[model samples]
Target chain A: MRLIFMIAVLAAGLLYTFYAFNTLNFLSASGRLGPGFFPQILGLGIVSMTLISVITEARRMRATTNYFAAPADAFPGSALLIICMSVLYLIGLRLFGAIPGSIVFLLAMFWMISRGKPILNTVIAVMAPVLIYLLFRQLLSASMPEGLIPLPF
Target chain B: MEIFSDLMMGMSVALHPANLLYLLVGAFVGMTIGVIPGFGPAAGIALLLPVTFGMDPVGAVMMLSAIYYGAMYGGSITAILINTPGDAGSVASTLDGFPLAQQGRAGPALVMQAVASFTGGTVGVILITLLAPLFSQVARNFGPPEYFLLAIMGMLTLIVMIGGNWRLGVISALIGFALGTVGVDLESGRSRYTFGSAELIGGINFIPVAIGLFGLGELFFAFYSGSHKKRDGEMLTYDGKSNFWPNARDFIETRFTLVRGSIIGFVVGVIPGAGAAIAALIAYSVERSVSPRPENFGKGEMAGLVAPEAANNAASSGAMIPLLTLGIPGSASTAILLAAFLMWGLRPGPLLMEQNPEFAWGLIASMYLGNMALLLISIFAIPVFVLILKVPYRILAPLVVVVCTLGTFSVNSSYMEMYIMLGAGVIGFFMRLYGFSPAAVVLALVLGPLAEESLRQTLTISRGSFGIFITRPASLSIIVVTIALLVLLPLIQLYGQRVRKPKAS
Candidate 1:
């Protein structure tokens, strides 16, 4: 898994390096380094480092079964659920209004993470967003997105 | 005379009702996070960065700084009673603190930690009050080459001295430098990597990236790592039987030790990359060496408890001097504060004292008030902190997610920034899994652009001659240090290994 993760990073670095080399202009007509110089340098560095990381990871994998001392299963289903919930919450915040969207998002999250206490989860789900709304919108006067439902602060 | 008058003006600002309230709140939040065993001061301050958007810069800094030292005070509570160091800095505390707890003297251990922390923090502030002006005076003479070299030296120190895989640290910093390039170029007036998006012209906002990386990334980690899962530990219940306050004899015995640790911590704090954890460890070793009862150092010795606790708090304050005087962060917490300074359009340096003396001196003044606030809170607020620990991660996690998402959005009301935050959070999660230092990346993100700008400006001034850096004495010295750290030290180590190999053969 660690090797695969490194491989992916190496691939990304290579692609970014290729794109930067092709598209970005490193030197201007005036003969000085342009805006692209630093990015190209960074891209090249990333490629070299990621390549080194891949080789190092492969050598360690060959030396031992438990190379990185990582957990047997670091990513469980709850983690996946949380990730999905985060994406869904982001989408909801854009589609619905900030307050209404957050209320639903909070309730769903509270329901999932709570210890099967519906009443407590529900109360928290309702109160948490309202308090946050009051803090950000009313107190801080932040300009939140007004989508389907306009929140009256 | 000018410094005194400026400090008085700062005192008035810090004493304002609004700023005072925030200081109390920040201290409470800091303590809460400290006792919880996972949420350290870095995340606590990062979590609250957005909320400070509405606040004045002085108040914002005052509140955030209160959280930093307050967390130090709170971490000792758990270290002494529960026998678990709240953060790495408090690991030394557990050496003697837990043993004292086992001996049923937990109350006295806690009292000593608070007093030691107060003493150290007070001394650190005093040192800062004295030393910051001298440092600022020196900093005023620095040019672009010096600034460039300073940034390089700062990055090198962070990458090498953080006691991790240096390779990963470099990669993390490179990644940050890459991200920093995503915005429009300041000098060339050209877009580097915006990919033709209009919103990209304004660049990636620091607040969302910060909130996502530290706040959401931490929550994501907790879910996967099970760090927030309840562990079995004996919680010491206070019965109001033991003396809560340290006796005069206790202070008299530990006074020199406290002073020594404070000075060590303050000096260490001013240097980049060495933070409270290193200070605490070094202070513990120094105290053990100097003590007559060296063998009793970790055996519930009073000096053991006082040394590291004082050192960590002192180091926390000491870390601020560089951040305030030079616009360079010495540690992760200071990096977040620097981000706040940038967000407020307030650059910290010698000119900050000249142009915005109220904001500059106000922060220093608030440190005094914050230390006093932490002393009072640490004595009277342990139960409150303990109660906060009872709020299960199940509830806490969701609330954090809401806060982070909302905070990210509130920065610019741009859904694109929120999405960028989400992406940064994911990247941060993987970076942590891969042993990359998120703090290194953050420091790079905050300093990389400034460093790049300075480098370019120096080049322009030198008419593209690379010799400009070496021509300047200050820049040359800093460049020499960077080379030693990045190159010479490694070669020497490799040579040592080769000589040892031949001996073994």
Candidate 2:
């Protein structure tokens, strides 16, 4: 998994360097260092460094027989679930607006994580969103996602 | 004498009702953030950055800076009580802190830590009062070559401090430099990586990226580590029923320790990338070596707790010097503070003092009052923080996600930025999991543009001569210091490791 992540970074670095070389000019029309100069250096640095990292990681994995084993306490499933819920929450915000979407997401998340305390979860879900609305929308005058179905408030 | 009047004027500005209120709120919030294990001042300040948008720049910065140092004070609470250092800086405190608690001396340990922190923080502020203007004066003579070298020096020092993971740290910094290359080129008026999007023209906003990386990334990493599933096992209780305050002998024993820790911590803190954690560990080592009762060290020794408590707080204060004088952040938390300063249109370099004396001095003045307030709060508000610790990570995790999302969205009202934030968060989690430094990434992102611009200007002046860096006296000085730090820091790190390894076994 670590090697895969490093390889992915290497691929991105290659694309970034490719753009630097092909699209951006190394020197400006005035003969000064241009946009590509720094990017070229950074891109090369990233690709080379990440490649070394990948090789080092691969060697370590090969050396260790239990390299593939997960730690006893790791909860990758819970993290993935939370991440998926966050994505859905964002989509829900686009569909149902900030206040309503947040309430529903929080309530559902509390239900999933905390469990067995519906009333407490419901109160927190409702109160948290309302406080956030007052703080951001009313007090700070910052914009919130109004969504397609905007609330009357 | 002039510094005195300046501080007086600053005190007047900081004494404003609104600014005072902001300071108190900031100190409280900072302490609260510190009590949570794994969350540090960087995450707290980043998460709260958007909320300061509507505030006056002076008040907002005061609050943020309060959060920065207040966290150092608060981190010791958990170290003493639960043996879990709230942040890296507090890790040294856990050496003697938890042992003291186990010995039923939790009250004295708690009170002594607060006093030591206060002493360190206050002494550090005094040094800043005496030294910042001089540092600023020296920096005023620096040119483009010097600025570029300073940025390089900062990055190299940070990477070198990453020890065995130096390659990963370099990659992280390079990634930051890449992100900084987005938006239109200021010098040539060309778009490099925007992909023709209008939103990308202004480049990546630091607020969202900072919030996502430190805030959401840490939360995700905490979940992955199964922190939510773990129970808080038998926290040592401090009822204040007996021996709550340190005796005269305790004070007498630690008097020299406090002064030594403060000076050592301050000196270490001024060096870029040598943060509070390193300062605390070094102070602990120094105190042990110097003490007559060295054998008693790490076995509920008061000086053990006092030395690190003072050193960490002082180091936090010392970090502000570089940020204020050189426009270079020493650590991730200070980097966010730098972003906040930029957001408010307040450039923090030499001229910041001459042009915005009120803003600069007011921030300095607020620290004095902030330390006093934190001392009182750290003592009296123990129960409140203890109660906060009881709240399970499982219940707190979801709410934090909501806050991170909302905070990122509120900044620009752009879904693209939110998406960027989410992407950064996932990357941040992976980076943390893989021994990469998110702090390095954020620091590079902040410094990349400056470095590029300085390098361009230097080359232009020297007619593309690379020798221009060596020709400039200031640049040469920075290079020498960078080299010296590179040599010395590892040895200091080795000493710290030697101190810890014996105890751990």
Candidate 3:
């Protein structure tokens, strides 16, 4: 079942990659080297490998107990934390911008990492991101996203 | 004698105060990251790369090189204390490293790692200094066929050698080739894989993927495996004080492991697909099999710690060989290093050695000096690293996560990158659960683009004859080797059983 799923995903990707390559006009011999040649071959490689893996995995399953077993919990609580944190971090970015959102995000993360020390960890996390923001933005002149809380002068 | 004169000149360039300052700063920063849990030398180097973008090519390379060795020295600290390798390369160290700590030999374990790393790195640097020019001269003769062959050879080994289901590994590699196709098709103005998303047109940046997979993926794994028993605590009071120097007998025992590992590291480092972590693992396996007291392994045996550390360090220097010579990056760290070169408006190719001998020679010299510095400082610094670990994981986790996110944000100010990071993090978290090797996926993601570019170029030249790869000697040899490995795996396993049968008897 998992092998099937993998093959399906691989096929989808291959098809998309092939179409993507062909859609762009790559059928020419103009320059020293033409454009579309690399993409098409890459697409084919992806397709061939995907097929090969599926076949091999299927064979292994037939010979042994099975191939590609999904565990009881493919997505666990800890992974959920990552999902929530990432989504929240993205939300923070959209709402606050990279700097201020990162500040809040880092603070919460610090709170998470410390396990029990909330306030102190939050302070360190918040301060670190803010200072990093200031350093990169002000000194390095790299433009960061303008989050809900803009970087204050 | 002539080589001695060049070495002296190289030292002169490396000794400049400006260069020295960067080296110190780089070493200090690199060690800081290395000492921290979860950040390997590659990740450490990636984190520090932004700081060097501002310096001159020579200074930048010097500092980066210093950090490379410094982080190597730092990676062992957490391994000994926590039994958790901060980077994959140091995973072997945990076999004996944490055991030694448990047995109150933490000090010696660390000293072993540092000294071994320095020896390997020093030898690797010497070899690189001698070998790079020779390789580059050979590379100068390379044509389109050679580059094409090199790419094929690179992909072939990756498919055969990396640990995993071989079929799945190939799938991963092919996917990587696809991703490499996403960025502005370098050979042509036409874009592929952009799918009208402007953010992606610049392409899926490999750095963010690397950081997300190694850094964020690891953090996610730690969280997922939170229920796994953590080590009780460090043996803070166990203070056996052996001389920091590894003695002659120690050398006699570990010399073969060190040499074998150095050679493996250098060779692996030169290959784009076979990286340092794999090299270290392979070396450690060899060390285990070869050791007279195999049972002593994973219980803080000196041999276990020495072999992998040496391989990991040598791999660092070895990776530079391909980059400097063939203008190809053997590993992710070197890949990032290559980006720095590009930003400085330097194109690495056949003529690179001829055009930038000073920059090349200076970087190699600095690595030599960096090795000496790492060996000198680590003698006194291991104690301090243990102290750092005692601060508690709870605090360290928060700090590391925060710093990682900030570094992620800084790498590109794009909040979108953070989203990509977040998405990748979530995917990575689940990948760990499903038994997918994050390293495999990450390497696939990292090299996917390169493979795609090479494949596309190969076909463009061949005009539909994919067999053109077989026509080239280098490419054909690599492809043949890959096929042989694919066929020989079961035979090798059978041979292993045959050898072990007598032992079983």
DockQ of each: 0.63, 0.81, 0.42
lDDT string, candidate 1, B1-505, tens digits: 8778878998998899998898888887888778866567777777788788888777888888888888888888778877767776787788888777776677677878888899889999988888888889999889889887777777777776555478888888887777777778887788866789988886766667777777777678778876435442335545446666666776788889988888887876776766787678778878877888877766778888898899999999888887888898866778888988888898998777889888888888888888888888887776676566556777778788888888877877888988988887777777776788777778788888888888878887998898998888878877776676666434533442342242234
Ranking by DockQ: 2, 1, 3
| Residue B277 error, candidate 2, Å | 1.2
Docking class of 3: acceptable
Residue ranges of candidate 2 with Cα displaced over 4 Å: A151-153, B232-243
Angstrom error of the Cα, residue B161, model 2: value is 1.7
TM-score of model 1 relative to the true fold? 0.91
Q: For candidate 2, give the lDDT of residue B251.
A: 96
The backbone clash count of each candidate, in order, is 0, 0, 10
Candidate 2: the clashing residue pairs are none
True contacts kept of each: 0.68, 0.73, 0.55
- Tens digits of per-residue lDDT for model 3 on B354-389? 787667667778888788877867777666666665
Better structure of 1 and 3 per lDDT:
1
Candidate 1: clashing residue pairs, number: 0
Docking level for model 2: high
